[model samples]
Target: MLILSRLRAYLRAVYCRQSFFPGPLGVFVNPFYLARSALQEAMRDSAETLNGRLLDVGCGTKPYRNLFHVSEYVGLDIDSPPARARGVADVFYAGKAFPFDPASFDAVLCNQVLEHVFNPDEFLAEIERVLKPGGKLLLTVPFAWDEHEQPWDYARYSSFGLKALLEKQGFRILNHRKLRADVSVLFQLANAYLYKLTERWPFSARLLFNATVMALFTLMGLLGARFLPDNPDLYLDHVLLAEKSA
Candidate 1:
């Protein structure tokens, strides 16, 4: 078991740092099972800018901690069942407002969090309030994801929509990136549905069933990529780097 775990970790390290083939099959070969290597790569690329006192909103297990060169890292999340299950974060708050004073952080990382917020305007307002002048906000939101973490999943944001919303909240967009291509999105949707369809089966059977389906869909995605032109509209998620006025 330990050997398998170590092997998985080794593969993940390779995938995040050295792998960028982006062929249809290459993207779906996520050894860590979440297909977040691209996202981790994006964060690592901005390590220099992310340095200094940082806040991780909705940080799950601080999975991207090593990617940043921050002086201080403070993770904050709501004290809910879902958050507690993750067993992470430095502080947990139950209210809508943040506990920190204004301009408290040099950088804020909010990963895949906006879609779960009930009031995005208010949520971003709090982040802006806590960020220092010229501080950067690194955020990711899904455009084509299935609803997970039920009751909390509220909305999805397109690349344009996210940019406009951030600007309205007094941020200057520095960079925006679509994280997944058409073939990847197709692969994810098919895999997700297959998993859902097998939810009621026994544990071993469900695992076997989903694995078989995923393997087939992965091949299909590769074939689709060969004939399909790249389309931004079919992107699965987006990442943004925005800044507060100095």
Candidate 2:
């Protein structure tokens, strides 16, 4: 067991450190992703409650590796990773059909990856095929945003839509949350837009605008989460934890 573990570790190191990966999410991860994540971590079921072999699909840069305390982790992506993708992935591959045996994983994490698939339904079905019976899937998808990474970009889904789709694939949602709303959404759009304006507006004006918008949104989350009738459904990121039906 120790020898095989070392061998897998060596192979993972060589594979992840290679060139051609999308660098770090810090570069391509979409800036607004942070604010949404803050809300998500605050909202629900984030801690790794399930312990078994795990897989993270389209795990660009692999930011959530630490959240799970699983026995093993595998991160698969279309390209090689920027740095060593943290957490633990035995191997990183180059396609949607993940290379694994049937029911090989206890859980799958597919964050911000589905929209980029050519056929998300088929891709998700593939996710279903790889999970052990009663294993879980943790996924996050976008609902609003311009098409930037097209060719790779596919479609967004509503909460009900995704839930129904997963049920059809033989999974049951344990918990779901849609994060980032109203001012938070506004700040995200403004931040992205104002970044472009840095070239247009003066440096001071741009910085002031960006800071003020961010502050407002941050305050909105604090104040609104109690009194603002905050609705996760009409938000930026939809996160779900679903179990493969028995």
Candidate 3:
């Protein structure tokens, strides 16, 4: 039992490190490899511009912490049993207001979190309040993806809808991108479905089945990209870099 637990931990560490910008092993094992790879690239490109006191909102495991060269890094999450199990928060909040002064942070990262917030307006408002004037907000939200995190998942935003939400909170959009569009999205969805279907199987059987499916789908996605007409409208996620108005 102890050995199995250690193995799970080691595998999780490897997945966290390489699942986003996957190599061969990651590509096969990670069901969401295509979308994650795109998100990671976008984040890495944007991370170059961020510095100083930074806050990571809904920072589950702080997977991208090493990407940024910041003076101070603080992680915040809702106080919940799942969060406690993940050991995800440096400071947990009550979901009303953040435990920080206005304009306390130079940058904020809210990756893959907005969809889970029931009151996005209040959430964004708090983020805007905490950010220093001209401070950056690096956010990523799913546009076309499955409902996850069970009943906590509340919303998915289109590109325009996301832009409006940020602008409504007095944020100026600096960079906006759609990740894993068109054929890649199709492949990703198929892979996700297959992953779900194999969930009840034994660990080794599930891994082998999903890995084979991922590899095949990845190849098909690549080929389709080369031959098919591009469609940016159908995408998996939205990546944005916005700034608080001065």
Candidate 2 per-residue lDDT over residues 144-182, each given as its tens digit: 655656676778888888888898899999988767754
Rate residue 235 of model 3 by lDDT: 88
Error of 3 at 39 (Å): 1.2
Per-residue lDDT tens digits for candidate 1, residues 1-246, read: 999788767755654443332333343443223235456667677667786899999886777777788899999999888778878888898749988999999999998889989888899999999999999999988888789989879998877778878988899989888865757567767776776776687644644554465656666665676787778787767878899888
Task: Give me the runs in candidate 2 sitting further than 4 Å from their true place.
Answer: 1-34, 39-44, 80-89, 181-183, 199-227
Distance from true location, Cα of 212 in model 3, Å: 1.8
Off by over 4 Å in 3: 1-17
Full ranking by lDDT: 3, 1, 2
Model 1 residue 154 distance off true place after TM-score fit, in angstroms: 0.8
Models 1 onward score TM values of 0.81, 0.71, 0.92
In model 2, the Cα lDDT at residue 134 comes to 93
Worst 10 residues of 1 by lDDT: 25-34
**Top model number, TM-score:** 3
Best by lDDT: 3
After TM-score superposition, what is the CA distance of residue 161 in candidate 3 from its true location, in Å? 1.0
What is the clash count of model 3?
0
lDDT: worst 10-residue window of model 3: 15-24
